[model samples]
Target: MTLFVDMDEVIADTYGAHIKRVNERYNMNLTKEACRGGEVWQQLPDHREAIWRHYFEPGFFRELDPIAGSQEVLRELSEKYEVYIASAAMQFPDSLKEKHEWLDEYFPFIHWSKRILCGDKHILRGDVLIDDRSHNLEHFVGRSLIFTSPHNVNTTAFERVNSWEEVCSKLL
Candidate 1:
C-alpha cells in the first residue's frame, strides 16, 4: 500500500521552528502550550508578519528539525510499504528547493520519485495519508491520520496520531 506523508509539521517540526524563530527574533519565551489549538502565528498577533516571513526566508525549511523518530520509522516503513513525502511546497518561493534538499539530507531513503511537492494535495492517490493539517486530509479518499502538532491539538474531525510511536502501533 502507498502511504503519503506530509513534511512540515508531520515529519518535520515546522511548528516548533516557527515558534522558536519568533521567540528568538522577539526576545520572548513562547512555549508550545501557548500556541495550542491554533497556528503558532496566532500566538504572536503583533508579529504575524515576522512569523510569515520565516517561511519565505532562505534556509528556513532546510534548517527545521525533523520530528523525533520520523527518519527511523519512515525508513523501516519503506521496507514494508510504498511511502512518499507529499508536501504542499508551492506556498513559499524557497520551500520547493529547500524542502527537496532537506529531504535529501534527512530522508535519503525516500527516492526523488517518491517525493511529491505541489500546490494542492487533492491530486494524491494513495491508501493512507498522514498529515498535520486537517485541511490537507479533508479531501483524501483513503484513510487520513491527523499527525498531532501543537497547533492542531484541538483537532477532532478525524483519526489522530500523537506520535510516530502511535503511528507504528496503528499502521505498522
Candidate 2:
C-alpha cells in the first residue's frame, strides 16, 4: 500500500515548537494542554500574529525536533509500505528547504524520490493519508488517518491516532 504522511505535526513537533517560541517571545505561559482542541494562534488571540510569525522564521523548521516515536514507527512503516513524506510547504519558501533537510536527518529511510512538497493536498493520490488537518484529509480519496495534534484535538471527522503506537496498531 502507498502511505502518504504529513511532516509538521505528524512526524515533526511543529506545534510544540510554535508554543515554545510564542511563550518565550510573548512572556506568556502556554502549554500544549491549554491549547488543546485549537490552534496556537487561536489560544493566544492577543499574540496571534506573533505566533503565526514563528512559522515564517528562518530556522523555525530547521530547529524543530521529531515527534516521539515518529522516527522508529515511520522506519518500520517504510519497511512494509511505500511511504512518502508529503508536506504542504509552498506557503513558506524557507520551510521547503528546511523541511527537506529535517526529513533527511530524521527520516533518512524515506528517499528524496518519495518526498512531495506541494501547496495543496487535493492533488495527492495514495492508499492512505495521515495528516493533522481535516482540510487536507477532507478531500482525500483514500483512507484518512488524523494524526492528533494539539490544534486538531477537537476534530472528529476522520479516523484518529493519538500516538505513533496507535498508528502502528491501526495500520501495521
Model 2's alpha-carbon lDDT is 0.91
Cα RMSD to the true fold for all candidates? 0.9, 0.9
In candidate 2, what are the lDDT values of residues 1-172, reduced to their tens digit? 9999999999999999988887787788989999888888887688777778888989999999999999999999999999999999998998999998988888889999999999789788889999998999999999999999988888879999999999999988
Native-structure RMSD, model 1: 0.9
Q: Candidate 1, TM-score vs. the true structure? A: 0.97
lDDT of each: 0.90, 0.91
C-alpha-based local distance difference test score of model 1: 0.90
